[model samples]
Target: MYLTATLDEMTEAQLLDHADEVSRTQRKCEAQVLRIAAQTAVLNSPETIDPDVARLPGRERVVRFGGVGTPDVAEFAAAALGARLEISSGSARSLMADALDLMIRLPQLWRRVEALEVKASYARFVARRTRNLTPDQASYVDERVAEPADGRIPWSRFEDLVAGLVVASDPEAAAEAEQASAQQQVARPTRSTEDGMRGFFIRAPVPVVALLDGRVQWIADVLRSLGDTDGVEERRVKAVAVLADPHRAVALIEEFAQWRDGSGERPDVDWSSVMPAITLHVHTYAGPEPTDTVRVEGHGPVTGEWVRRHLGPHARFTIRPVLDIAGQAPVDAYEIPERHRQAVHLMTPADTFPWGVSTTRHHQIDHTVPYRRDGTTGQSRVGNYGPMSAFHHRLKTHGKWQVHQPVPGIYFWRDPYGATYVVDHSGTRRLPAPEPPSPAERAVARALFGLAA
Candidate 1:
């Protein structure tokens, strides 16, 4: 009876078609195995190994034993022998202590610091933010914290110092600071010299070093020529180009410059500080148009031309702008590429109410599920407090700011192009898609997995 039923099912054609599909999948898998084996044979020979690979000592031995199960004592020892340095503080106190330290060590860090006034100001900032401090941590506020000394490093300078002492000195470690000062200094307008061009800085985001396709050595050469200002210049310097995801673009230029040590390797630069964070939307235009201009109450009237010129043609080529203000373009302002506009929007206020926008206001457009948390809000904002992609709203009833929420990851989309993603507790890596799930895909996954019927 069982044999007869099986034969009948196969006869139905639909069931047979499913079986054929399974068979085809199995055959493809087998063919892939065969191809992999053939390639392995051809590629494995000593003659086929590149000269550089052959020259490496114990190259074959290392490759053969490369696994967590097989402990390579030599490799383990090599990694373990690297240097380690400790800084004192709780996670809460550390940022304060470290920031103060950076200011002391590298006063050039912040653009301005009145000798007495800024010192008191930063000390107060540190004191107010710290929570649940131990006695030692508390002492960092009142006792350990020293007033800014004459010519002592400011916030930016202190960041550079730590990058040098902590990151530059160690090969295995990653260094991070809130500011990159050297690049900003290089960007300063200066007198034209013998080089046919006045000095200009090319500070890229620090993470770009690992991301670019070209040789790291070539990058180092570029960095070395940047001069002591930590910037490199070409025959003609145009705009000081800065391309980085918002907020995550924190790191000082001196830290970036440190990649060129005795080894002479050029390091990627950080462009964050060079592009100052925006407080309010300023419109730019070729000329002022009546509807395209919006006067940000305290800021006077900002025209579309104002926004356009500041963005420049480079970013506008890719990012089209949308006027978040309800009525008009405010002035003869055209939309920039949506992506570039969002880049500006992420760090500034774009999604807030019409009357609420201003450059002087302090607010960061925050991701609801921060890129640090694995949430699906793309770099673009779509709806109002819709579980993701929340913007800064000044009103109390509008709801809480998104930055306050915890997430598995947080990311910023660059454009329709690739996304700049920062995984929770990991170094930032740019991926093709900011988040993995689409709404349609999510709905399918939910049904398939018996998650939501």
Candidate 2:
């Protein structure tokens, strides 16, 4: 009886190992059957490849069926399918190779599933053994396995639900609706560049009339065009020009009196306030050069020399196409700060440890690489500290530590998804977080802990 039982156990293990191979064979068979059905459908109908003959067995069948044979229909009948056939030798060999490849890969897939099961079991064991977890950690484990609360869903399912609703209401319009939905998915959220530029304006050597009202508008249009174009990764451009000052123009007019045949005074337009005051001498950069140089010919060559000469002692201002210059300072002297201020974001409650085991807490802080020891102040700002719990701090202080092979989760759980939730107990359910001091449950828990709200 013992020998028989041992043999049965070995057989069961063998079957389990080869389960994936069996599944692969099943899928291959299903695919072949589908292909055969499709091929057969093409050969066995009035809509056959020739499209001429409708009846099989040709003239005799047409007479037997009491239908007159059309010439087109007769031609279709001639090519009718006679028998179900097997795939050719070359095709069969190729299919066999694919199946064999799948069979060879079975071990890898099996190993992955086995690994996942083993890891999950280990976590369960640890959770059950370690009874000191905080309320928060226990709740998190429960939340993960429970049905999603508040109907919140992952993105894939959200999209599927939207499509199903659209399809159910208007079946005929489904294709167009789906296409429109796809387009919406591809479009990024629209933000007004104008909002980021409330205080700024670009002053080119060109007229404020030209630069602000006209040239700036043209630049925005160009950026829109760039966004629509395929294969353009990123782009930057600078414009410069040599503009004649209002005073120098009189002498320039005397130099070219012949051209002064403007017939009469054609209204002296205020070029000072209307047009920009500085001259552009040169500009240079190593980025996407304009594809159509002709479009920009009216403006100066935009060379580096032009930029330096007209824009003053490289201190007054800087200019770039498609960029707002208002919130910015003059380019010659201004440098972007090396440090920037950012808002301190709150951590998700889902991740916060509960009942604070100092070891686990310290582990998290150390793992997160929070504030390093500064050698002077015993305390550091939270920003400087890696995200670790108070628990981990205790361990490092008390235990003989392994600097190289330190306990995991010292600073933070590096990859939250990487940690497995072990079963602490065999299918035990946990209650939800108690409602705020409703003058009832909160009072009870607090009373037990000997505290007051």
lDDT of 2 by residue, 333-420 (tens): 1111212000011121111232121211112333222233444442222222223245544443444222221222222221121221
Report per-prediction Cα RMSD to one decimal.
Answer: 25.5, 25.8
lDDT of 1: 0.33
| Cα lDDT of model 1 by residue, 1-453, tens digit | 233355555544445445645655654553343233223333443454455764687663222211112122222212221221132223212333333333333233221232222333343343333222333333333332333311133354323222222221221222112133214423344566775655543444322322231223333344455443343433112112222322322232344455435445545554454222333333333334223433332233333443344333323233336544322121111223344334434333322321122333333433342232334333333221112222433332244322221322233323222223332211122243346677898899898996653
Which 10-residue span in candidate 1 carries the lowest summed lDDT?
65-74
Task: Write down the TM-score of every candidate.
Answer: 0.17, 0.17
Cα lDDT, model 1, residue 255: 40
What is the overall TM-score of model 2 with all chains considered together? 0.17
Residue 265 CA displacement from its true place in model 1, Å: 6.0
* Per-model lDDT: 0.33, 0.30
Off by over 4 Å in 2: 1-12, 45-453
Q: Which stretches of candidate 1 lie over 4 Å from their true place?
A: 1-256, 260-262, 265-381, 386-453
